[model samples]
Target: MNKTVNQKAWFLVLPVLLLVAFSAVIPLMTVVNYSVQDTFGNNQFFWAGLEWFEEMLNDDRMWGALGRQLMFSGIILLIQVPLGVFVALNMPKKGFWASFCLVFMSLPLLIPWNVVGTIWQVFGRVDIGLLGHTLAALGIEYNYTSDPFAAWVTIIVMDVWHWTSLVALLAYAGLQSIPDAYYQAAKIDQASRWKVFRFIELPKMMGVLMIAILLRFMDSFMIYTEPFVVTGGGPGSTTTLLSIDLVKMALGQFDLGPAAAFSLMYFLVILLISWVFYTVMINLDKREG
Candidate 1:
């Protein structure tokens, strides 16, 4: 006997397919069109072919922005992943405190990105802001606007404060999923703290950690608005990550062709990194299985 597949289920998925095409594919097509052509106002477009792509590839500024973006993402992963794991380890397993902690941890994630940036912008000011006033009183010169180093530090710290909680919460959920029986088995084996984690908890949490890293990497690579609102890509282009540079090309400079090429390259870099991360994670899962 031959078996028939359910064809009607596709109907249920049609709306979602349409939505994604509209939201993602349509915008991507627009970018692709712009990437290969130049318009000299009045909708008069000239074929530029790969000229913009070549220019962007040769641009020192593009390379610098990419370097800065990678650095930012690397630092964020280093800081947030460990910190999140630590926080999860220390959190109460079950009780009102757990509930309270969950709510508190989620508060940062709840805030809008732009609002978070604005808050940090004010919070970092040398006058009227608590951090600024305290640092000033302590005889330290700190100004994100005028100092490149300060601007970099401020953006890194701000991102950490905003997004670390997400990693912590995901890690906590992963920890909670580990059975109590595992801990009991570890105790019976006379396992040390390191052994328990290395053998049991760490393995279990690997999936969630991969997810957290992937999310943070993508976000950091594409981060705009927040850093843009805060630094405005000032202090000598220190914080001009790819996204910032792309915007500057698009709106600031009004060079649509170059901007389009920059954006396509930017998208490809993210896609490549994400693919690598996903492949590694899939392989790890296979090994563990």
Candidate 2:
């Protein structure tokens, strides 16, 4: 006898579909409408077609911000992934220590994004903050608000501190999912630490590592709050990534049409890159299988 498929599952999914439509789909459509239209002083909208998009495409400031965003994201990924893997590899496997470590690792992720920015903002102050005061006492100039390199370093370090835990946790979960037989097999082969990790652990952790990479890349590309709070995109826009620039254009300058166009383009870049990542991941899975 053939087993019947569940016909009632769609009924259970209908509420979720409605919620997604109302929440994400509706807002996105509104944004698309704004991107292609112009609004006057009295709140009347006129169809502008691709006027804003053309202007944005030719704008030097947008390109600069995009470049900076790419560099920041690259640096963050290069630093975090390897370091996180190392930390995860060294963490205790089981016991109260493991639970305690896991809880501690998750603490940073639980904090609100704005609050994380605020904490780092005050924490980096030169006078009252421990980091600034210590650096100043050592006769080093440590003002992120003035110096470009200093501002970059401050934001990079702040991001590393806030997000590295997420990578570590994902790596840890991947490591934990491995069977003990893999380790025993490696030992029987007289595998070194590097060999064990390279041959056995890395392949097993590939899925979660991809997830970690994707998460980190997306978050880094769209980052605004922490760096905004810490450096305020100061020192001659040295740290002004795309998100910060978009906010400045829309809110600070009150430029409606260009800002809307900028946001749409920005969203498209993210969507395209994320799609590429998904496709590559699918192919990798197929190859491995």
Candidate 3:
């Protein structure tokens, strides 16, 4: 019953493993090293142990940024998931229009993150931007640079515009995978639209929906470039999420030790929350299954 294993497959993957080590592992190790030690210039470093971690933990600014980060991520999920699913439900399931719709839906996701930010930054300017000028013409006091609420709304809208298409596309794929027989059966059973969705489509889409939720959650939680470019964490740090704050600490103030420590904590927070989301969704899927 003993057959020789194909150990040679490892050779094919070795390059990828090496690439990952060089690209991700090495940089991670450097961050870890920086996090635990303090430097006083002249290429000198001294052990700081967990002092930076403690300081970061106690810092109110970090806490505020974390709160805003969590709030932003939560809002993104709440809005994007439902909207995406609804869009998927309404999208043409087949034919040329379906192909066109797919291409159109993909347009936003195709743009680079920084480019999306820049586009929004210009688009939201009150003096010249179409949206801003129209709002101004209507006497709407919309100023993202000066008003915290407006800044939050603009970023949220921007994110929704940018990422909801991803969720819709995923959901659409899930819908496509469902057997047409199920719809036929539902029709024969005199099932209502809501009933068919609840009893058939929704359950079938659950796996992909979970994926969409997790992806959106992680992306939103770690969001940086777009909001940073659009709002620059302005209106008195009202929109200063964790990533922006981390960059400021690391580069703006050159607090390397603390910044490194903060980054590690940030990584941990993302990892932990992602794990929780994955676990909960898996359990829910299992229960439904």
Candidate 4:
């Protein structure tokens, strides 16, 4: 006999669906409309078809921004993932110190993104900021505003300081989930530290590690307010990522059509990479199961 489906659950979900439509779907539809049309003030819109998309594709500035974005994200993953895992591995697994460490590690994550950026921006000032003043006193030329390399380093270090704790916390949770039996077994087997990690802990942490990678990748890829506040996309656009460029197009330049198209493409890139990461994560989970 076939079981009857519980249709009443739909009632509970209806309000959430409506809210999502209002909050997300409506705005997305507006972006789609702008992507295909051009307006020259007076509320008059002309059909532009894919002209804006084509222009964005051909724009060297957009491409440069994309390159910078990818490089930033790549560097973040390279630095944060390994560093986070290492920190997690070294953290106390249990006790009073563990609780203290958890609270301390969470401090950076608790800070708002804009506030973090502002803090760094002020903290890097050569005349007053400790970091800048120390570097200056040491006779090292350090200026984030004028030097492209310094700006990039500042942003990268700022991001690392801000987000690395997230990865560490996640990895720590993953490590905590592993049973003591595994370590006991490793000890009985005369396994080395590296061997135990490779054979037991690393494999167990794979799920959370994948999650950390995906999260950091998406955040780093779409980063805006922090770097914008810190660098203002300056030193000759060296630190300008796609989000900054899109804002400049939409608000700064008031070119809605191109900005909308650029945003859609930007959304697609994030969606595509996220899908790839999700697929890998799912496959890994399946294999473990």
Q: Which runs in model 1 stand beyond 4 Å of their true positions?
A: 1-12
**Residue 218, model 4, lDDT:** 96
Query: Mind giving the per-residue lDDT tens digits that candidate 1 earns over 131-168?
Result: 87788899999999999998999999999999999999
**lDDT by residue for model 4 (1-289), tens:** 9999999988999999999999998999999999999988677899999999999999998899999999999999999999999999999989999999999999999999999999999889898888888889999999999999999999999999999999999999999999999999999999999999899989999999999999999999999999999999988899999999889989998899999999999999999999999999999999999
Regions more than 4 Å wrong, model 3: 1-13, 280-289
True-structure lDDT of candidate 3: 0.94
Question: Which candidate leads the pack in lDDT?
Answer: 4
lDDT of 2 by residue, 1-289 (tens): 9999989878988989899999988887887887788886477789999999999999999999999999999999999999999999999999999999999999999998889888878888897888888999999999888889888998999889999999999999999999999999999999999999999999988988998999999999999988888888988999999999999988898777888899989999999999988888887788888
lDDT of 4 at 251: 92
Each prediction's number of clashing residue pairs = 0, 0, 0, 0
Instruction: Return whichever of 3 and 4 wins on lDDT.
Output: 4
Report lDDT (CA) for all predictions.
0.92, 0.91, 0.94, 0.95
Off by over 4 Å in 2: 1-12
Worst 10 residues of 4 by lDDT: 37-46
- Residue 288 lDDT in candidate 4: 100
TM-scores for the candidates = 0.95, 0.93, 0.93, 0.95
List pairs with backbone clashes in candidate 1.
none
Model 2 worst lDDT run, 10 consecutive residues: 35-44
Q: 1-289, model 3: which lDDT tens digit per residue? A: 9998898888999999999999998998999999989986676889999999999999998899999999999999999999999999999999999999999999999999999999999899998888888899999999999999999999999999999999999999999999989999999999999999998999899989999999999999989999999999999999999999999999898888999999999999988988988998889788878
